[model samples]
Target chain A: MPFWLDAVRRFERAIGVPVERFVTSDAYFDLLPHLKRAQSQLEDAVAAMTEEWYRLVNLPSGSDVRQMREQLSRMERQIERLTKQLADRDATGPTPTVRKRDQNG
Target chain B: MWPLLGSDLAGRVGRDLERSLWRARNGLRYVQAMSRPREGATPKDVVWKRDRAELWRYRSETPIRYAPPVVIVHSLVSRSYILDLRPGSSHVEYLLAQGFDVFMLDWGIPDERDADNSFETYVDEYMPLAVDAALAVSGAHEVTLSGYCLGGVFGILYAASYSEPPVRNLVLLATPIDFSQMGPMVAAVASGRLDTAELLDETGNVPPDALYTGFYMQAPTKEIAQYATLLENLWNDEFVDAYQAMAQWSRDHVPLPGAATRQIVDDLIRRNVLASGRWELGGREIDFGDVQANVLNAVAVKDNVVPLAVTEPVMQLVGEPSKRDELRLTGGHVTFGAGSHAFKHTLPALSRWLADHSDELDSPKER
Candidate 1:
């Protein structure tokens, strides 16, 4: 072991205990929500400004790309569902349709 | 007295000079990112894949002693490499050496396309198929479903929802069952102070940065402390390599799918359904009592991520008392898979329980 290693370990412990307590404290948790809200608002504002700039320049924005992606994703999901249904039908065979005259008889 | 003082001074100076030289050399390597350790280095093959999910079956030179194959389900929010972190420190490596057939179910990083994937998508669609693929490849009648963190929640839900799931044994590592006991970050979401919808970006997934921030808030100064420890241990090459590997894994996070995030926020966090036994999925009520597999819940005593309070209650909720067991070990959350704690305590105890429950093969299968 190095000569300074012991001193460094002691210093770390001295600094670590108090910081751990402060972070785990109720006061810190109470302040967290406000910080998160501010961050979210800042992000939203920046995105909105960027979108506005894109519109003024006659260019597509991130939201436009996102919309297209969402449409594609929806189509993919529909195809998956249809494929699953077909597989299930194939496995169990097709259901027989009831005739009105046969039902009445 | 003067002569003794001079000798002591000389010794101290020499040690200080040596320390400085080691620090300089190691610091350069760290900065240049040279000789960084490789993670997930174990040899494995993808037995099955659907969308972004993959089932990896690890290869072994030795024949298997256990009958049923063990499949590991990793957490959604993080990468799966933590289990196979390094050569000697890997959990999967230990299991393979113990002569057990091992497989890993990894949920790859989600993008916009996976935004609409709900719990139903994973439980009903992906998990069953992954298990079937493992069974098909291994020619095993049943498998031991082992899950870590949120993966354990998925396993519990899957086993409980299905009438006769082909799971012979279930192992949970640092899994949180009682969400009410989870810390303030979860409480903020449950209390509606933080809107989960607002957290989703244009990509239709919760960004990795946001998830990292949540984890960071739990212990703001821990990273600084870890750096200090790293500096102290920088003189040792082995210590530095291990530290670098763990540090990289800690910072690496994956985006959570939008629909699954919403469902978890509403059903698991806010309602606390699993703890209360009121959870339902796919038009069926999920009852832990319905899980017929033998259960093992491993809780880390020093884990702040998933405290004992949150993880210990699963013993009462799942399976019969005779079939359920708990292994309470002294270490942090990642200790079950990595570090000396895993090799010394976790792997041995876990393997003993698994071997007791598993049927022995008549003869070892050749590679």
Candidate 2:
């Protein structure tokens, strides 16, 4: 119903799917590298990775696999962020609004 | 007036004028394809074997290993020799001189049985098989896959999907990626206003006249109206050669498999699949990331079948930096390939890009 949703919906309609409402899938770890880039929210990256992968493969409409992949990515990103925040609190009582990934890996 | 516009009077006058122009283009093509080689008109020989998939090879006389061999895969709608027309204007000759091996996959005209053949047959079966044969002959682990127009689209799709394709670089010339922007030719085929199945039922392969009429209808100004004017300008010999060659080539067309046409319209034009990055071929997924090789997305600034807006989307789809690059310049779709600008610029761009990025290429056979 929103304009952004409508734009994405138009794209999905052209793509012949319900990507807008579909939940993410379990193949989330495949996007680990991409998720590292988006510090704040995993939903956006998960959504992108799912929709694009589907188009590339030319899968038919309503692919449960693609949805599962997105759902996993979002959850992984969220958990990864929570772990980082908790570690950051232990290192210092209060943190600055700006956050960064620990790049030891 | 209908006859004046559609009558034999108009056709006769139009044909005569076009005959001259096709002659000039063909002459230029002959000179381009053959005149060099230092040996005169003797064509570089191939073993010439006929397989389920029709293919021909033109090894350069003075062979050089600049890149892996170049495999030319053209549209299902035409003959392969269009690229190797004569000597001067041949695309194969030019690539051979540039120090690359060349092979062409010719989808020979189909008959009644071919009507059942689908796009999957070509992408899943014909093209991949051709690549295997070329790799076996060239002994090169990777290649520069160059495809023209619709052939380019198929080439891009194939290169993207196949795992570790024996391709060093992917070249897409005047290939359409976003069919939504295509002119009336595709739109008619897409909207179901033109029933592909019914037409295929009536005729095994879609007729050449039907294809030409659709293409010409898009630019009647160039196809008919311009010829009406060119009758006065026919004195030039160059004009005569190019006109005759092009006219002959235009009328001579290969039929598209009915099933193949159906898939293309449904998946590409109607559904707008490829650009969306969800296109599936041969069971495996086809993400741009899968094609880690260098890509040269060369688009003609003025093409009708594959407009710049459409053909250019491949650049956006691929990975960054050394992975992909684009050349957005002048020339109509097919003309950019054979004419003067091609030699002056496009060939060099292809050569330089391949040479510079040759290191990033994976030669699976090398190990």
Candidate 3:
């Protein structure tokens, strides 16, 4: 599986939804990557979603396959870059968040 | 003394002594809220309301009862009741009416064991358990998850670190991603005047009273002088009731576990790791990109604890579609969940957004 798909599947489970329909739909697969702006993306997605994506992810404002793909793609890359680094072996242990308290009664 | 022992004189002395004894009776355990009580959770100004844990399960009300639920995970410092204060003021109640099966985690004040608790415990234990408990209660196949302030960070961590998190639309309110920019308090913790290690050692959990005092001192006038003014200006029953309720809530501090407090300081505040997306909790590495749900980022314009400066960094990390709408509320931190205004401003926007994007989420892995 593609790194994006592998990562997307994990988040899909985390988010709890199907993806094949989302990625395969005609309206989304051909979505342009350049028009990543939220507003235009929403307008275009709403226009296309009336047919293709009204179900997979029920976003309030209409967002197209192009924008959703862009967003998810960005997220996928981020997760991959971040998690891959942490997965390295020289890692000691995860640091813990601390709060100090004065012992005096 | 013997000469003045007449009944009348002695009785007078006895009365004086009794008055002195009576005055001394007020012991200082949990510092009592001095002013009269007031209503704690009335919606002064709100918009929409409702909640649920996962996607598809937390939906808007009416023609939408079948709407999926949205679970709201609240911060540890404040009470969840803030989300559901008065009828006109309740966030959870509004969501219920909106058709979302609302599940909320009220991390009731931490005791001694809670002190031993670490951030890992919250991410691994409390949050997951809360998610599981909510699922069992609602019996929903999926749920939507949202959080405010500390809870927001927890939501992100839980979603990112775990291969399977029970959430759909991920919402964050007044949550900070970059601790390096957190105002004076963060500076203090970063420095050691607010010695987290020492404080934790004294008691397993840092006392709520001390934390409240620190926060109060951050804005002493707001905590003290303002209340005195409000008392003078508002004389109505509702005013008094509201004052008392808020007063009680403010004073009702929950002890933070020593370990958890330590980790927060060392990992986030001190190391400034969460922003770098290098934070870890509960034996899992937190990767913000791991969160790919439809996100609704609501920020407060004048948030002191989680300032907008830090918030922007958090949103940018989402990697999700930045919506045609990012809501910046026009009030303090608490207004997002309290008052009638929240319905109009906060909940409606939230529920409407969640409803529109509920299905992009998945369910828990079957055991």
Candidate 4:
């Protein structure tokens, strides 16, 4: 093993002491909420601007893509369920015979 | 003695010169060859599929030794290809050779769309669905569920939540239980230098670059030192090959969904939820003591990310002492799954343990 690996390990251990002391202090957790709020506002502004640009171009937006993705995902699940049902039926063989009705109507 | 020394020194110089010339000639070709490192070299079929997740069953030529199929749940933070890295260095290949039908549930790369996906999405939704699919594909009623790192956290939560888990055996590789025992990254997060929720809000999903930043903070000098070692051993083909492969694997970090990031920050890192055993999902209480499956808590002793303290507590929480086993080996986090030591020592022992606990070997026809 290289001598530096031991040095790195020792350095890590040395740094942990101060980090632990700093983190567990009450002041650290207190600052979190404020940071979260500011970031949220900035994100919203960026999203709104991006959405507007995409809208002006007459192209689908992120929201539109997300909606389509969800729709396709649901369809995929439905297909999977129907495929499984068909496989199960094939495995056991069909039990009930199909009856023709309402053709006259 | 002087003449002998002189002749020996001359011979050594000649050999070094020859080796240097050889390296100079082939160095670029070697670099090019290493650049095209093939990952997930094992052949597998997609047995089950869900949104951004798939269960793959690897092809096996030999008869499966164990009846209970093994399902590996990979850490969401990175790609699952680490377990199936390459031909000689694959955990999946080793398990398959041991006559165990193996399935890997890979959570493919998450993007902004998956921002809404939370711990609930994985523990309550995708995992159960994947388990059912694994059972269906393998024709086995029960499975040996193995998880690596964050994936193990999900596995443990799932195992504890279900009244009677469909899993016969549970394996946790470098899984953290006590978040309080987390390393400097957790310390830095707790220090309030940055608000995790706000960071997640800015980017709907936590970017890989941010995750890399956190990892780098833990050992700032490690990456630089690794590069130094790589350059020093550039003339050695074997060293270069291994280093290149590992370097590529390390670089392939995945984004974490925002909601998932929030939960990890609040529930896991800050609150130390897993240690509390009061964790709830979908109004259901998840107590670690509720898990009854034969458990193997395999921890890498030298693992900096999920250190010994972070993982050791879970062994005490499990209900059955006889069922709970620990395999403490000396390696870093990812090395347990990919390193040469794992192939020779840990993997074989792990395979035997699974085989011994499983009743699947008794009835091949049933499978």
Candidate 5:
């Protein structure tokens, strides 16, 4: 093995133990929520800015496309469900209508 | 003494320089190889698809195994191509060659619309349907369900919920049942360090990067170690190809549905529902003791993502001790699917187990 390679492996092995312990430790995990919150806020800001840019340029934004696609998908699912229901009803035959017995009685 | 030390130092420097040059040359080749497309090499047909998820049957010229079909349940976080990575290094190919009918449940990328897709939907609705599809296409009455990572969690839940499950044998590959042992990922959620609710609500979905980054944080030195190993083995063609293929798969992550993420937070991470057997779905309590399928729980000894402690509890949970089996493999998280040792030991062991328990084959008249 190369001298540098040996050194690198040694360094990795040395740090691997402590790093694994620390990374999974309670102290580390406890701080993640705040970091995640900040990250979410940052992402929101960037998304808003991108949308604004799209509006200014008179081009369709990502959110707009997503919304439209979602609408289309929803319609497709509704149609599929309806089609299945129609098939089932046909297979099962029509339900009988209730008799007008109250007036006769 | 000074002259001897000087000569020794010179010789060491000379050897280092030569090795560095060789590594640099190979490293360049590694880079070039990486640019090529490197996943899903096996030909497959989408036998069935529902919404974003699809059940794929790999095409094979070899005769099918007499055992019931095997369907791989991929994790929600990653794509399914990792199993069918390349021709030589594919788990799907090996299973196919071993005569097992291989199918994969690929949960394609989820969008904002899938935000409401919850655990109940996956375990109760989609999973059972997928199993039915696999059984239908293969002409098998039951399927040997093989769950990888989070997929195993879903598999366990499904098996527990259904009294007469379509699954004949349950194989869990590095699946985490005890969330408390999931290290930093669970710790973050358990301690309120990572507010899964706020993140899901704000974003409507957990993007691929967010999920990937969470795993990355668990082992910060993993990438460095991986690259260093790559550099060392850059000269080997086989190593380079495998590395490139795996690296490509690693980058291709899928966004997890928001509702599912919420369930993960509340049920698994925070409350430890699966471990406690208190998780109920579709009016059925998910008790592993109810699962009657022959269970093969394989846990990786060196798995950093899902630690050994995280996976070991499932043996006790199963109803029958005689039917329960465990294998401690010698690789980390991704190795069960991609490692050479897996192809040698893990896949073959699983195949034997399936064949051994095959009801159709065991029955003389049916055979």
Candidate 6:
């Protein structure tokens, strides 16, 4: 390692302690919720605009596509369950039946 | 004294010049992306597949000496390559050498199809079938279930849910049991300040970048520090390769399914179900005391991803006191599977505990 790089590392270490402390502090966490709320509000605004644009264009919105995909995923899950049941049945084979008394008896 | 000092200075200058040249050469290669390090290069055959999940049986020339095979369950939000990171530093490779028949359950990259995959889907549906497949392939009645991170939560659910779980031994690596201590991002969701629904994109999943951002926020300056270190060590090929592989893995995250995220936030984080011992999955109450498998909960001392406080409670909740053990390992979260610390300390300790619990085969079975 170079001498200059070592000095840079030393500087980094000096500042890093306080930076890390602040990042993990209660104040940072308290500030995060507000930031998250603002982000969510912005996302909602964009989504509403996108939906309106899709309505004007006579095209399905992203939300619509998501719903359809979710429905398809549900059907896929059902099919998977059915397939698993069939496989389980095949593995177990048919249940044995009780034999009746002979006709001669 | 002056002559000696002059000679020493000259020697230092000469060495520094040589290193600078090597650094320049290596930096050029790095920028061009030349001689990229290969990762997850260990040979493995997919023994079973369902949806995006695949159970991989690692190929080994050595004979299997253990009765019950080891089945690794990886976390959903990351690639499974971390376990088999590189040939020399792979946990899978280490286990193979230790004479355990190893199988890894990799939840492949998820998109729209897996948006509805919840805890029940993993714990109830996929895990049981994956375990059965591993058992059938290895001709073993039971298996040693090793789960990493979120996967370990699934292992806990699976073992506790079943009356007779086929797991003979359970190993949890850096698995979060108390989500309240999982840092600010999770705390936001837990406190209901940040809704999980807002995190989901149109694909009905939390995007990879979102997950990456969450992790990145934990140590915002770490990336800058790492790059500085990387630049300094650019002359060393071994260091360069290791750095590249680890850096790639750190940035690489997969989308988390929306339904699973919701459940995780509500049940695990908000309610703190795992810690409280009051979790219900698929109408069945999950009780950790019901887990009959001998448990080994390994918590990394310096894991920012899943802090020690987040994982330490598992030692109290799981199985009988006599049947459970905790390993407090040194280093960060990835140390259990990758890097020098794993090869030196983590693997040996894990293998020793696993071997002690495992039954030896009368004769070794060839691959």
Best by TM-score: 1
| Runs off by more than 4 Å, candidate 3 | A1-105, B1-66, B223-225, B322-325, B359-367
| Candidate 1 CAPRI level | incorrect
- Give me the chain B TM-score of candidate 1: 0.93
Pairs with backbone N, CA or C atoms under 3 Å apart (clashes), candidate 1: none
Candidate 4: the clashing residue pairs are: B65-B99, B67-B360
Per-residue lDDT of candidate 1, residues A9-101 (tens digit): 567668877876776666676776688778878877897899999999999987788788878777776776787678756855322121111
What Cα-based lDDT does every candidate model obtain? Answer: 0.82, 0.61, 0.59, 0.75, 0.77, 0.84
* Number of clashing pairs per prediction, in order: 0, 57, 92, 2, 2, 0
List all candidate RMSDs to the true structure.
Answer: 6.0, 21.7, 26.2, 8.2, 7.7, 6.3
Q: By DockQ thresholds, what CAPRI class is model 3?
A: incorrect
lDDT of each residue in B58-143, candidate 4, tens digit only: 98676776878999998989878888877777889888887888999898888655676788888876888788888777777788
lDDT of 1 by residue, B230-262 (tens): 888777788887887787787788999999999
Better lDDT candidate (5, 6): 6
**Candidate 2 local lDDT, B1-367, one digit each (tens):** 6766678777888887787776566546655743332221216544233223565667555546455767777887755655665467666777666555667776666654456566666666567656766776666666678887778777766766654566678877777778888765566557665565544423355766667655554434333333433343444556545554555565676677777787787888899887786566555556655565678888888775678888878887753456778877676765544566666776667667656755333422221
Ordered from best to worst TM-score, the candidate numbers read: 1, 6, 5, 4, 2, 3
Tens-place lDDT per residue, model 3, B237-289, is 45544554556666666677677777788887888787886565544456687
How many Å off is the CA of A12 in candidate 3? 54
Per-prediction DockQ, in order? Answer: 0.19, 0.01, 0.01, 0.06, 0.19, 0.15
Span of ten consecutive residues with least summed lDDT in model 5 chain A? A96-105
Ordered from best to worst lDDT, the candidate numbers read 6, 1, 5, 4, 2, 3
In model 5, what are the clashing residue pairs, if there are any? Answer: A33-B193, B65-B99
Off by more than 4 A, model 1: A1-22, A25-30, A47-105, B1-22, B32-39
- Compute each candidate's TM-score over C-alphas: 0.86, 0.63, 0.61, 0.76, 0.80, 0.85
Query: What is candidate 1's DockQ?
Result: 0.19
Could you tell me which 10 consecutive residues in candidate 4 chain B have the lowest summed lDDT?
B358-367
